[model samples]
Target: MFECFLEIGFEAELNTKEDPELMEIAYEQCKENVATRATAITELRKMIFARGECHPLRTDDEYLLRFLRAREFIVPRAHKLMVRYCTFREQNKHLYEGVDLWGLVKVKDAYEGTMLDRPDTGRLSVFRFGRWDPNEFPVEDLVRAGMAMTEIGLRQPKLQILAGTVIVDLEGISYRHVATLTPTVAYQIVCLMGVAIPGRIKGVHIINYSWILNTFFYLFKKFIPQEAWQYIHFHGSDLKSLHKHLDLEVLPERYGGTYRGVSSFGIWLNKIKKYRDEQFDREMKQLGYVIKE
Candidate 1:
């Protein structure tokens, strides 16, 4: 288990001010407390070294806080999640092959269903899969694109604290698109969403549902865990129902909102591109990502 090692200097100074409302949510929902945060992070880091499995990881408080928040501050569960995250990365190295900020932004179509310009309650992120051209972009590229989005999302401290919501628009989905998701591929997607990623997904709103999607879910629900299933919702072309879960003001016109601007993938790509800086590049390298200049 200790084939390679990276020693992290664990520090006791883990105090960073957060909004009072968000702090309340973190304490009430995720068991996070400024008072005990340093202790929890220290314990989590110690467990990582003691287990000797999750080597070469980002042991900094900000990074470790993601897992702690995701697991509601349980050190053992956070440790398991960290191990699962590293294991998933190792086993599915192909999915992350070219997942870099600059490179990913160039793949314009990859951002089709994404809504990142502004966030809904708690930084809601959306992806519309119905518009994706499986013929032009392989499903593997879709996974890689999603990985890039997750990497960027992890960088936002507010997102980690408030958590996020996902909206999967299936407006024009076809059988051809559903066929691309093999059982193995579906399982991997589920693992990436439910297990690997160290962010809390409060709700997953599925709009524009079709029999095709219904049939697909019936077949693939086995791959989804029970807890994740609770988050799954079906809106079926009713924007009103979707609005109940997310803010109608934040949704684009296509989703029956008043916002009159293009929310295309390219726009989001450029937005996140401008978000990069020296610190962003260093953090990406720490996570073992290659940044294409």
Candidate 2:
């Protein structure tokens, strides 16, 4: 059974929670080139499935629109990103194998506590990554866990086709943890977080990043393009400084803020673990390959 913790108001506008003007940056391009991009998305959807290697549901207008928003409505860029996302899934078979959801949790585990904690800021999906022991789980499982949450998050009303914020708490990560990010793994992560996923990722806050964190970001930086990379924010241990940008009330107790709900990580884990079966089925259908459950 899935034990839900916090219930957020998904109806809140991004303008109210975040800087109203900055919100335009996410969809300004789409608004400017609406007709052309929409047409291209329609055509590309048909072209992609023609090869008989895609999910019809993923090609739906609302679903594909998220990718367009992520790419600022640039058809080619959006198409390339979609293709890359599908390719990444194709390359990894373990994602669809036995107990992937629980496997991901047991290995690369985490959930969007930021959402449940701050119901008003549900649009900003924040996750804590300090506890993820990279030595036990490779980058593949990392991507699996991230993508699994993304899929589940989309089930929320407006989140289906909207971009959201991503906050990663980097408290306990060490040199050995950062060393695990190889070029291949780095590229995979960038594609998933930066390009592949439809969400605009209005901002990526790396809070509590330690001095040693710079080395990891240095290696991780090469894979991300400048435009998307520019949104990445580094906030050291200063909770007040980080709260200045991200609403202080939206944070958890660790950062000197309160959750106002069931503040247990296990409750958040169940929220994501419930989606494991659907994600595996999704991979099986998207790649045109069948995996016996």
For candidate 1, the per-residue lDDT at 286 reads 62
* Regions of model 1 farther than 4 Å from truth: 1-21, 98-100, 106-120, 259-262
Cα RMSD to the true fold for all candidates:
8.8, 6.4
Clashing pairs for predicted structure model 1, backbone only: 113-128
lDDT for predicted candidate 1 compared with the true structure: 0.69
**Candidate 1 residues 1-293, lDDT tens each?**
21111011001001233446677777876789889999999999999999988774579888898899989999999999899888888888777644555665544643443223233355455666676777776877777777766766666555677677777777777898888888777777777565677887777788777778866676568977777878888888888888887666656677876644333455555654554567766766666677765
Candidate 2 per-residue lDDT over residues 1-293, each given as its tens digit: 11222333222211112233433443443342444756867866776677555443466665676666656666667777677767666665455434345444553235454444222333555555567766666656666666655654544324533456677777777876777777777676676575665655667778877677778777778878878767787778777777777675666566666654322234444443343355445643453433333
TM-score of 2: 0.69
Cand. 1 TM to true fold? 0.83
Best lDDT among the predictions, by candidate number: 1
TM-score of each model, in listed order: 0.83, 0.69
| Count of steric clashes across candidates, in order | 1, 0
